[model samples]
Structure formats: structure tokens, C-alpha cells
Target: MPPSGPPTRPPTDDAGARADAYATAPLLNCLLREVAQPLDGTDEPRVYRLPSGERLLRVRGVRRPARPEVSVDGDWRPVGHAELVKLVAEELQAHTGLSNPELPAEMTDSRDAVAALLTARDGATSPEDPYRRSEQSLLTGHPYHPAPKARGGGPVARWLPYAPEAYAAFPLALLGVREDAVAEEGDVSALDAFGTAPPGYRLLPAHPWQLDLVGPGLTEAFADGRLIRLGTTTSDTWPTAAIRTLYAPEHDLFVKFSLDVRITNDVRRLWRHDLLSLRRTDSVVAAAAAALRTPGAWLSDRGYRTADFAFEELAVLVRDGLHDHLVPGATPLLAAALVEDFDGTLPAGLRDPDAWWTAYLGAVVPPALELFARSGVVVEAHLQNCVIAVDAAGTPVQALFRDAEGVKLLPEVSRAAGWERLVYCLVVNHLVEIAEALRESHPGLDPWPAVRGVFAHESHRLDLPEAAALLSAPTLPGKTNLLLRWTGANGADARYLPLWNPLAG
Candidate 1:
């Protein structure tokens, strides 16, 4: 046992074993958190019962559950990815009284995708830039999603070149929509730098992978000269963890595209409605971000361009880069990256872990709560949406938030509902994951008290009633990803179950 109790690290160095461990942890977390009933006070291997106690499952480790086993023939038999997927399907179908053939396949596909990524990553070079490396480090994408890495069940070859985990860098496929057929809004001038259009066309850059996916359907448009291929960008755009969005380091801009494939809960597309409402939502959140006394910024979604004929399919969004927003000398790393793995990016000895975490809480927590209380803007402060800038001493000094599409505005959503969402995103999804990661690294160090201190301070500082209520609340709303997928609910229709609040006293 390696001090933190029975070793959380895998028993073997085998690639498949590592991949299985990486892939299994998230599924096991979802199974245990959302569906499984804990048989607390049970000995060594922690145990949980399925919805009806018909099946007993147990796993080692708490933060990232591992070596899942089912009690069979009065003995615990370890289960692999396939067996686990089948087990999950059986339990979900029995519990929900619904059969989801798609989710199970996605679960299997996700495991296979992880296997492919693990193999590709072994021989691939990690990005030289620290920020880019941090962004690409998420081999395990969402800690709670059942299939966080499912790449549409497509072949590895089709998806590997664009995967950030593989340190992918490729130019955007430039296209020219006939000037009269172009649909554009806001400032898409950044797209003009990639390549020139013909005399009567406007520049529109598309994700090459998305182009391949939508290519077959574009035969008619190509034949009619509504769209023309204009080669590729001279500079390569690196895909961020949100695979559809790519960062053009040379141009200092972010270009997000419409990916038809489903990632996690939704089809990763620049949706038509979301595109239409971008300005309204982003402007509100941006204003709140700008008003912050704390070190924080919102990477604005500047504008978008697409073919009027294929509105949603080829739509591309232009977003602000970090050059203008980042603190003078501070490096802005993806917040998700911190929880995933630092990969030796941070200098270790500058600050004690607790002090570093306190600085982090101050930098990240205030902005979301202030925005929610004063401006009625609920920024999705989830791990992926945040970029925390650590000073030279590895202390968090600033936070930059992005993805305007995810921000929810006040009057449009009821106050009660908005507050619920803010708590779920900022506290449960974002803080809890990062806190757990921090705790795992330095065992016996409790992080929640500092979190409680931050919340208490914010509640008093902002005079927000919701913040006070949060500390005393017995349970926090946890998004039911596994059940949501199994029930085939709309991605936007979030259903939550109570997760015992860590801050509860």
C-alpha cells in the first residue's frame, strides 16, 4: 500500500491494462456515483449494490474507482471494459425500465477509442508548449461521463490525426462560399487570413474532419458552384480538448466548427439557435467578466461564418485568443489539465500545496458567484470552460473562461433554476474534481474547508443568499449523465440526483 491506502495506480505496466484502468475509472465513477448504492462499513474492497440490490459490485479506490468486480458464485470476479459495459447496461435497463442499445455501444466504443489513443500516444510527441501540452493531457476526458471519449464509433484512423491527446496539428480546409450564398455575423475577418476566395466568393474555413463527414452530402453544392475548395491554411490549428475547436497559435485565434458526431451528451455542432443567440449571451457574460475585481477574463466568441445553404453543417465560430487576455507574464493552462495531470509543467517547490490551492480558490471562485448574484449571468465554470493562469511560483493568479454557448442568462431561466445550474457547474463539476485531484496528490490534506471558507466569504461579500444556503445544504445536484443517456433524454434537458455535499456540516 502506497501511503494513500491500497494503491490506486494500476498493478501492471501493460498498455492494455493502463488503457483499461484509464477507461474503467470514469465508468466506475458514474456507476458508483449515479446508480450504485454504497454498502458502507463493508470491509477492504468498497462495495455498492445496484438499483435493486440484485447485483453487488465492488471496486478499489475512491477518487477514481478501479478493478471493478461483480460478486459471482459467492466470489468477486474482476471485470474488464466489455464486461463492465454489459454490466452497466443490465443495471441501467433494469433500473430505468428502458433498453438503450446506443449507449452500450457508445460505452464499448469509448473503451476502444481509449485503447486507440493510448497506442497513438505512445509513439507521438507531446506538444512543446506547456499550455498546449496541458490542454492535450486529458486521456480521461470527463471524470463522470460513462463514455467521455467515444469518437462516434468511427475508425481510429479517421479521428487520430485531429486528436489533441496525440498532439495533433493540421491546417483547416479552406472553402469559398459564393458571396451571395455566404452567411456571416460579427467579425469573421480572421478567416480571411487562411486563404483567398475566388472573385465572387467569401472565405470560410472548415474542420477537415467535419468536411470529410459532411462531404458526401455536399456533392450537389459543389456541382452547382455554391462552394469551392481553396486548399488549406498555411498555418496549422491545434485541436483543443473540445475536439471541434482548434487554436491557431500563429493567428492567435480560436476557430470552432460544427462536428455532427455526438461527444458526451450532445452532437458537437455549432447549433443554429446557439449561433443566433451567441451575441446576446456572450455580451452579458463578457460584461460580468470584465467587471471582476479578481484576475479573470472571458474569451469572447467574436463571430461566425458559414454557407447559407448548409447553415449548421459548415458553420465556424471565431473566438478571442489568450494573448490579449492573459496576465502579463503568467501562463494560462486549461483548468481541466490541472486536475488531469500537470505532466511536469509546474515548478514543484515554490508554494506548499495548501497555499497554492488557496490562491486557486480566490482566483476561480469569486467570478462565477459574483456574476450570478449581481449580473444575473450564469457562466458555466466547469473544468473545461476555465483556464487558470499560474504565476511563476505555480500559484493561480488568474482565470479565463470561454464557451459562450454554455453560459445561461437569468430572466430566460428562473432564478432558482439558474442558481441550481451555477452550483452544479461551478462547485460540483469544477471545484469538486480539482479538489479531489489536489487531495489525491497530497494525501490527508482536506481541501473542502478552504472551499467552505471561500464560499462563506463569497456569500458575505456578495450578499448572496444562495451561497449561504449551499454550505448547509445536505445534497448538491449532480447531473445524471448515465441515466440521461440511457433514457435518451435531450442533452439540454438535464436531470440531476443528489450527491452528498462535501461542504455540509
Candidate 2:
């Protein structure tokens, strides 16, 4: 399939205007969802009141909110992306009675990053492969993040060559760690396939950008022969939506690296604590996926390799490839791409909303619910986490789930907390966006009844008390991302607010 009309490259003469709109949508969504309260507005543009300051706010668009206006001196004034950041900061400080200098800068950085991505796209060639297009199509990044595209305030030149948004693919930087300092776990034989190491060293492929980020810090290691640069691999690995993770098609394997840059909620590092327990978590998730009666698959984080001195910074994780798990002849598409209306790839000219939604629901819902019901595992099946495979006709046939770091097992956390996260990730984060995107085109279509039906069926089949409870609950847990960031809470420490349940009767 040819590459889709990249949403980042609009026909508009002003690239800044396109970048501003792209960046502003998700920021407004975060502000509106987390902090603002709805007001009775008898007008075209919806109005809201920022609860802490009693400031009147108005916004346009349903899915990704845009064209924000705040009332001043009895007149509504349009707020640009920068002004929106300031406005959000002021409202958040008053609302929480806390100060945060970092979030505002991150917000500005996110907008700047979009401008860079837009500029890069003009010169860069988009990948022709359907899967690659789907992976790189997330121009808006996250639907409800204050600064989803923020690249840790780094230079564009440093990250552009490695960015999936720019359809970038490059050979892995091969490093040889002295065997004594080589820290590893589980099956990491896949690393040997990339390139050979020196006489007393083992191969550890690193994300080139990550290597540069931590290179200066590893001066002593290089000096002491603990680490040695063995140059780059022969094959090129294309970056996935998760910037740190890469897919090498020649090997049909995924290699995840730790980059100290913050993307969205947290610093995207493969922490030592997490790596220590990676095997245990991945095994359970794999088993859970195995127990599923439907066509579900889990891309396991098979093993990891890093240096003892700089474990977290230099860590590289090996993940299972799509070839092993996906249905024969089916193409895997990122779930996030489905949420973007202009992604221009799969389901763009989708007809028969009822049938398509049914296929999608069949492909996605069963795996998430059944995994929890049978094995007490929450797979964090959000848009980024889920992968939907479609038949040649562009009809979804299977769902594959990944990222063991995000998975939570029962008894590790309370059943209530796990269930809330499952609902948020699966329903609120994953399904809601896709449903809304579908509704935007097929206006009269109602996806809720089908969703409720699936829930009704699965809950009854598995006798899941939480799923049954959700059928009648007044609200679903909506994560407080904007507030959480503003208050300097841990990204994993999810705090949720109530959203009116569409699943409820």
C-alpha cells in the first residue's frame, strides 16, 4: 500500500499554523478533561469554566479540542498554543495551590517538537509499507496529553534521524561490553545476530541516539575497557511509535533501548528495578495471552542486555516479532493510527460501520477482558499497547498486545486498582478514541451498544464481577494526566476522575 496523506504535511502554506493546531488539540483535551467544568453555553463553540479561577473558556472540535478562547473583560479572546500553556499553568497552580515550572516548559517544547516534525516531514520520505505508515502516522501523538510530542527539550537534529514520525530507519550502534561487566537475563541470543563483538566482549546493540546521549557519561568505561564502540550493524532498524523501541525486519525481532529523554509522562528509561523483574512480568503476561480463546498474542520482552556500571542507561531489551504471532498474510496496524481520522491508511474509506466496528471489537475486546478474567493480568491495552492485524480487505482479524513494562498482575496491586486501570486503558483510552473517530465520519453510528453487548457477553461467559459491575456503573475512570503532571506525581501513580460511562445502560 502507498503511504497515506501524512496529516503532518497539510497543503497549507503556513507550516506553523499546522504545527500549532496539531500541538494545541491534545493540550486542550488534557486541560478540558482534567481541570475544566462544563458550562451551559447556547452557542456553536462549546464553553467551559476553569473551576479554580472561574474563568470562562470556549473550545472548538469534539475529539481533539482546538481553537481555545478564554473570556476577558466581557469578551472572548483566542488563545494560541503558548498562551494556552500559560493559562493552563495559572489555572493548575490555583486549582492545586502548587507551583510547577517544568510542565509549562515541556508544553512549549511539545509545540516546538511538532514544528520540527513538520519541517522534517517535508524533506523526509514516508515509508511505503502499510505497517510502517500506520506506526508513524501518529502526528498528534497522544489524544489527552499536555505535551505528548515533547522530546525532552533537545535539539531537532539530534532526534530527527531516529524519529519514527519522520519515517526514519538506521542501523543500530553496536557496542561491546567487557564480558565481566555484561549484565543479562533470559534468552538474549538474538543480540548475536546483529554484529560481532571483540575477543573479550559481548554484542549489545544500542539506539544510536541513546548512545550519544549517554556517551560522555561513559568516558571512564571506555577508558577502562569496560565498554568499546564496535561501530554499527549492517541492517537498519526502523523505530516504532515508542521511540526507544526498534524493529529490525531482517531479523524479525524488536530491540528496546533506554533513552533518558522524557516522552509524555516519564523519562523513557528502562530502569534497573523494572529490568530486574522484566522476565517475571513478561512470563505471566505471555501465559495470560496463551489462555485467551481468541486470536490474541503477546510480544514478549524475551531478555535484556546492559552494562553493570550503567545498567539503566545502556540497557537493551529483546522483544518477539510479529511474524511469530500474527495471522498468516495479515498486516499489523498500530491501534493509535485507527484513532487518527486523517491517518489515511487503514479504515479510511471504511464502509459498513456496523460490520467494521464488529470486526474491531472482535479483534480487540476479547483479549483484554479474557486475559484479566482468566489470569488476573492487566495488559495496559491502551492505543499504543494494542496492535490490530487486518486481512487483505482492511478488515481487522486479530489483536496483539505488547510492552511487558506496563503489565500489572493481580495481588501486586488491589483488584479495584487493577480493574480501574484496565477500564481506563482499554475502554477510556483505547476504545473511546476509536469510537469517537468512527463517529466523526459515520455520524449516526452508535458503537456503545456493540461495546456493551461484548461486555455483557464476556462478563457473563467468564463470570467477571468487575465487568458485570461496569454494565451498570455511573462512570468510568478518566486518568488525571494534566493534573498529575502539574503536581509532579509519578507517571505510574495513576490518579483517575469520573467520566460518565457510555458502557452503562
Candidate 3:
């Protein structure tokens, strides 16, 4: 008899093809669920109900959307605005049962089109429809995100890729051109090196320099020697699709970027940090470098890794050797400085700075003692977005920050006139944000010793009460509703305060 076990079939071209298709499994699943099936073979596209209950369409001639074919710096031909609207509307009508009548009148209006379309598909009109809105809501209006309209009629500093129809939850943006001009057809790792692969992932080592060419708009900038190269790092430990790099030209310092767009439920760990209530926390950390007499400017590209390339791609460039000394581990201090008051309340095992387990607490403690009011602004201060550098003695000597993205600036202060906003941001929002992470990661960690360490390292005359006040105060929850008292896109008020000032009473 034949082998009792299952017989293995020889691998064929079809088998190889099946293996190749796995990379696009997510996209295929999307198409299959959203497109509909036809009763019989017909020349026209057919709508089918997927087993998952999603509507999908199978077009006879149309294939899956291929990776972008155009080269970097190529002339960009947009699908005209009118044509785009027609395409979107037609696609929705053909695939989903909803017709023009079912759509909100606002959808027909070009100004609110996207919003209206989302509402219609979301079943906002009826109570019974089960439509799961995409995750785009998480970041769409996030305070740290650049305003939709450019600040000065120019493109915002950051670039994000957005897919209106697919994975709308993922606020996609272009980082740069792919490293390769052509599809690999065999080994795609080469594409990754060339900037063709998604962010937060690295190509196989065999791939060459992974140089992604810059786009035309920034060509003159590079030709004039306005841009410089920066150093690169690839971290497999972090989420995929994140990249970080730093560059400095004659005057301005720049950071290369990308982010891991996936959302995790570990909200407390990443955002809503407790350390954002510290006093002059930004200055305290920045002062370390001044005291150490370190040279050059600093930028935060900590959220992502930076790739090294010969030329800029899609007009994006990463400079070399800019942040060589800056490393990841230093994050714990910056986080410590943000929150943790030394004097006020004593939780057991927290007061003694000299104790062994408590010794490191002094590293996170403050020197001055005073009752300092806390700010209410919540900050997404995590290890990934912070930087601290230490000296040979293991003393934290310097701090660097970057990635204004995810930064929550108090709307009132951001728009108002004064250094209060900046002070609140550097000290209250950014510096202390990292502190919350340290406290949470190390359960046995005490706030005072760490607070005292920061103050002692910075040469602050130890005043326990003031320092305690700074650390003990609870940072504002980062919820903006209290700041403006109004919600739902009515536009912001002229007076907005990012940091909560309860002392005003």
C-alpha cells in the first residue's frame, strides 16, 4: 500500500505562486471580504457576499492595486478632483447596496465629502446598523498631528500616507521613495533597503546600501549643499515600520522619520504619563548638556529608526553621524524628571534616598523642596520617544528630544502669547512624560530618590518642598474638552491652555 501518511505533492509553479501571494494576505482578505460574488459568469464585475459577511467585488479585468509604479521625482499626475469624487461614488454604489439616495446630501457636496461618506457607511443615520468605524479617529485630530491646512500655505514638515478606502484607520503617509526603481520579481529584500519596503522593517543584509533617491522638489536643496547625511540604526525589538535618523545642515537640525501605525491597548504605558507635572523639566534635562559642554543641536527621531542612503528619496534625506552619542537607555531619566515629587507624601520605601533599592530613586528625585502646582495636560511620554546620555561615571549628562508628533500642546497656550506654553511643553509635557514610564516599569522604584538625583545632577540647591510640589502634582489628563469647553470641529478658541492651571482660582 502507499504511504499511510499524507502524500507530498511535488512543488509546481502554482505552489510557488501560492507561497508568493502570502505577503499580500491582508490585502487579499480585504478584497475578498468587501467584494461581492456573482450568481453566474458574466462580462461585468460581480458583487459577492464573503463568508465573513463583508461585501466584495470581482472585476473581470481589474487586478489588485499594484505597488506604486512611478519613480521618485516623477511628474505627479493626480486623478482630478472631480474624477476622484466620481470614482469614489461609483465604487461605493457598485460594491455596497447603498445608492446615491442612501448617501447623505453632504456626501455630494465636495467640501465635506470624505466625512459624509464615512458617516453613511458608518450607519450614523440609523440605530440598528452595525458598522465599525475605522481607527482613523485615534489620530485624525490628535493634538500632536499637524493641522490639516498647512500653517503657512506650504506643506507641513511631516509627511503621512493616507488610504481613503482601505485601512482607513491607518493614517498612512509617504516617508520617501522606495530604494529600488523596479520590482525585484524575486528577492524583495532589495526593495526594502531602497526605501521600497514599509517603514519599521529592514531588508535582508544582502541588499546593497538601500539608498532611496530624493524627489525633484528637494533636488535644488541637496544640490546647493543645504542637506547633510546622518547616522542610521535598525531595531528589531520595536514595532515594524518605524525608522529614525538625524541630520544637521549649516543652520537647522533635521530628523528622518517613520512610525509604527499599529494601535495597542497598552494606553497607560505609552500615553497619559504621570511625570508631565515637573518644573522646568525640559530645562533641567537640557541644562545637563550645557553643563557637560557638549556641542551641536539635538532632535528626536527616537520613535523610529533612521536608514542610511546615498541620496534623498521622495525629497526625504537622513544625515549621518548627527546623534552618535545619543542612545536609547537614557530614556528612564527624562521620564523620571517629568513627575515624582520628593517631599509631600511618603509611600513606604519611598522617602529614603540613601537606601540601596531607594538609591536609584534619588536618580529620579528632585533637589529643591517646594509645593509646585501640577499641570493637567496628558503626554504620550514613553521610552521610544525620549533620549538621555550618560557620562563615564554613569551619570546622565545630556538629553535630546525629537518627533513633535504625538505631542499635545495646550491649545490656549499654543495660540496665546508667552513662554508659558514652551515652558509647559518642555518641562511639563515632554521631560516628565518619560518619568511615568520608569515608575511603572520598575514597581519597586520610588519617585523621591530619582527626583533628588535629577536635582543633584543639575546643581539645584536642594529645597525639598518646591521639588516635592513639582513632582507630587498630577499632570493634566491631556483631555482638551476642559480647556475649550466646546467640541466637534467648531474650530479652536483664541485662549487655550495646554497645561492645567488650577492655581488661577
Candidate 4:
């Protein structure tokens, strides 16, 4: 076990205030983007006209808008998180002429979850390693989603122990599956080293939280002797930004499990179909990474293991760790953490904003485009799936992409559809967020020109005609998460609305 430390509690009032700030930004982002219109010709406090056009709203910050107020009786009255949920529900109903009772509860659950995480983090000690610190630092997640932090309305006690935001690390629950009932594909040999199993069984490591969620359902298997508990791993595994995936520093490996709770859009389970098709998708991405001219890597999802009786519920995937793929002496940082802000992740001080911006684009952009154009593999290069390795001087040296389950093949999807998805994931979701973050820090810097230059330069070398067209396109597609949630659409069903393209000049 890892060494333990004494717990210290931050004041309740301070924790609540921090939670409110973190929760409000994402809610306000949804309202402003999907339902509210900017009320032009205003100064100081920015104002917005609601969908009804009768009510007006105003907020205080630029990047993270706060202190929301609604106009009533010609006076502005502050709205709390509860009132904000109510207001969003009413506005969505008015705009779409459809109502969803579940989303409001989810919005409230998200805020309450944040409050719980803040309180837990007060008594917790952060990981000493910079990479682990970056992985766990997301307080307000998914800037555009309505309930990015919601954990399926589970009790705080049930989920808080595993939350990445609270700096959590715990040993994985090791189980022994009867040899006859074991189901596995590809290379899952890495799992065997975690713990020992009996002669007639194979070793299977499960996420403690996931096991907790599915424990009752597995009682029959345990009773019948098909599954046996084999204690926990000797070393501690820390949760990454994606909560279900845990990293064991000692082994230099990642183990992904089927988390039952809803995060962002979907119930984060390793669905049976995705697991069955994992090897093919991973192989294509691996091939693409090998062919890239730039220094980039792909962390392959090598294999998974589960019991035949509870395949989807008990499944766990093995992924490559950062050690082997990383450049010598380079430190790997989660790309999302770079945008969200974490200690020691960003450069000490960026002397030249333009050069810094160029380095970032150079490391992140080419690989995705190259994969799409050359190998017909569309890697999900979103912020969460990408890791940017920086040298000692804090310059981005290489880009590493992961999550094979999210990769799409060109022949599988129509060319036009694949291109759109690639553009959305790489440009709109990844680059736009990073650029805005850079602009927020360096107010005088205009990062878009460097972005335009990178795409233009790449267009001449790559065969993608879409790259040239993207340069002059009027708008880019932005995923409609707010509407998707409200309408109860499949999480993977991406529907986009036209967003003004910054690349278009």
C-alpha cells in the first residue's frame, strides 16, 4: 500500500463557495449557447435576451460567466443554482416546445456532486507526481455540457471515494474467474501480474466502484463458485481524468473498467460490441501512428477480459501506459488539463505567445489529419483522449492519442461524415478550447493566425481536400450536447449546429 497522510478539512463555507463557482460556469455555458442570445450594445455586466424575448439576463465573467441575474419587475435579481436549473428548464421548454423532467434533476445532481467533491478534496492530499496531479485536477469538467460532473444521481458516499477531482487512489479488486467461464480477446496477459488466481481460474482485476455497482447482480456467480474474490492489488492505482480508467505507476499500465454511472453523456461501460471490435480499431490507429512524419504515438487498447455470464458488466480493458511511448526526458501532460489549468503543467512563463501557440498546434494537429488522409483511421483526438508531451523548457514535443473504442474507420463511415466528425473532434472540440484558454491567459495574443497557418501548411502536404475547404468555410459544426440530453438522444449520436468558424478569414 502507498504511504498514508493525516486528513485536513477545509471550511464548509469555503468549499460551498468553490463548488458554486465551478458548477455555475458549465450551466451558464449551456444557457448562453443553446437558449440565450447575447444582448448587444451593453457594457460592464454582459446582458443576454432569453428565448422568450420577454426576460433578460446578465452575468459577470468572460471565460467563466458568474453571478447570473434575471430581470423581474425591471430589477435584476440574483439566481442561485436551484433557481438557475428552474430557469433553464423553463427557457428550453419555451424555445423547443418540448419538456424534459430528467435534465433538471441532473442539473441539480451535477451541482450537488461538485459540492461533495469540493468537501472531499478539502481533506485529501494530492498526488506528488505532476502527471497524476494534472489527471485529477478537473473541478469543472466539459465546459459545454449541462451536467458534466453528474454521477448518475448516486449518493455522495457511494461515488466520492473514486472521484478523480478529489485526488483518489485505491487498490483494484482482484477476482478469479473459472477457466471455463472466462472470455477474453487479444493481448490481456498484463492483467495476470496484478494478483494470483487459483489453479482452475484466471486473474481479473475490477474497478472497486464498478464492482460495488454490480455486486448484487454477481451474487449468483459467487455462490455457484464461478467467481471468487482474490483480494486487492498490493500497489495503489490512481484514477485518471476519465474516472473508470486507473493508472498503476509501479506497473506502468492502465486498466479500464465498465463504470455503471453516467458521465457526460453515456453510461461509461465497455459495451460488448466495442470490446469485441477493439483489436481491429486499435490496430488501424497503431499503423497510422507508425507512419506519421511527426513525433507522435498511439496508446493501443491491447485487450480486455470478463466472465461469459456477465460479459459487459464485468469487462475490463488493458491499455498501454505513458513510459514507453514518451520521448526521453519529456513529461506527458493531459491536454485537457492544460486548458483547465493545473499546477506545474503550464510553462513557468510563456515569453513569446506566438511561438508557444505554434508549438502547441504543431504537436497536436498533424497526426490526426495524417491518420485520416493516409490511413483512413479517424482518431478521436479530443482534449480528453490526447496527451501532449512537453520538454523540460515546457515546449510541446509530441502528441499521443488514446481510446481505440472511439476511433472510426473511413470505409465504415461515409467520407463526408468521417471528415465532419474528424473536424469536430480535432478542431472544434480540441483546438478551439485550447486556443481560448491561451487567449484567456495572454489577453493581447491572437492565436487564430497561427492556427490558420498550421492548417494551410498541412493542406499542401496532405491529400485531404477538406483541409483546404476548412480554411475558407463559413462555419464549423458544434455538437449540440444540451439539446441531445434534453431529447434523450443516444450519446454517440452526434448532432451539430453551425458555429462561426475562426479559421474562416
Better of 2 and 4 by TM-score: 2
Assess candidate 1 and give its lDDT: 0.86
Please identify which of the two predictions, 1 or 3, would achieve the higher TM-score against the true structure: 1
In model 4, what is the error at residue 303, expressed in angstroms?
A: 0.9
- TM-score for each model: 0.96, 0.97, 0.29, 0.96
Model 4 lDDT tens row, 1-505: 1112223554645877677788889889878877788877988689999987778999997767899999966899998888888988888888899999999989888888998988887767777677787788788888888998999998898988898988989999999999999999989999999999999999999999999999999999999999999999999999999999999898899989999988989999999999999998998789889889988899989999999999999999999999999989888888888777666325324777678779989998988888888988888899888988888777888899999999999899988899999999999889998888888788888889889988888888896788989999999988889989998999999999888899996
Candidate number achieving the greatest TM-score relative to the actual structure: 2
Q: What is the lDDT of residue 187 in candidate 3?
A: 17
Q: Relative to the true structure, how large is the alpha-carbon lDDT of every model? A: 0.86, 0.88, 0.27, 0.87
Model 4: worst 10 consecutive residues (lDDT sum): 1-10
Per-candidate clash tally: 0, 0, 85, 0
lDDT of 3 by residue, 1-505 (tens): 0001112233332422332222122222223323323446554443333332332333322222212111124432333223333433444455454455311122122223233323333432211100111111111111121111111111211222122211122211223323332111211221234223344333311111112212334465445443322223232111111222222222123323221221111111111121122113333332333333322123322222222332212112222222354543331122222222111111112333234223332322221011011222222333333333433333443444333333333332342222233334434444343333344444555444444455444334433333334344443222232112111222222233334422121
> Best-fitting candidate, measured by lDDT?
2
Per-candidate RMSD vs. true structure? 3.7, 1.6, 21.3, 3.0
Candidate 2 — which residues are off by over 4 angstroms? 1-12, 41-43, 52-54
Error of 1 at 17 (Å): 1.8
Clashes of 1: 0
The alpha-carbon deviation from the true structure for residue 184 of candidate 1, after best TM-score superposition, in angstroms, is 1.1
lDDT of 1 by residue, 1-505 (tens): 0001111233244667777888899999998888888887997589888875677998888878898889855688889988999899989888988898999899888888887877777766667687887788888999999999999989889999999887899999999899999988888898898888889999999999999999999999999999999999898999998999999999899999999899999999888999999987887888888888777789999889999989999999999999999888887788887776656433222237788889999999998888888899888899888988877666788888899998888899999999999899998898998788777777767889999999999999999989998999999999989988999999889889999999985
- Write candidate 2's Cα lDDT for 1-505 as tens digits: 3235554455455768878999999999988888888877446599888966558889888887788889955699899988888889999998889999999999998889888887888777677677877788677988889899999998889998998888889999999999999999989999999999979999989998998999899999999999999989998999999989999999999889999999999999999999999999999988878878999899999989999999999999999999989999898889998877535544556768889899899889888889988898998899998889988777889999999999999989888889999999999999998988888778889889999988888888988988888989999999988988999999989999999898885
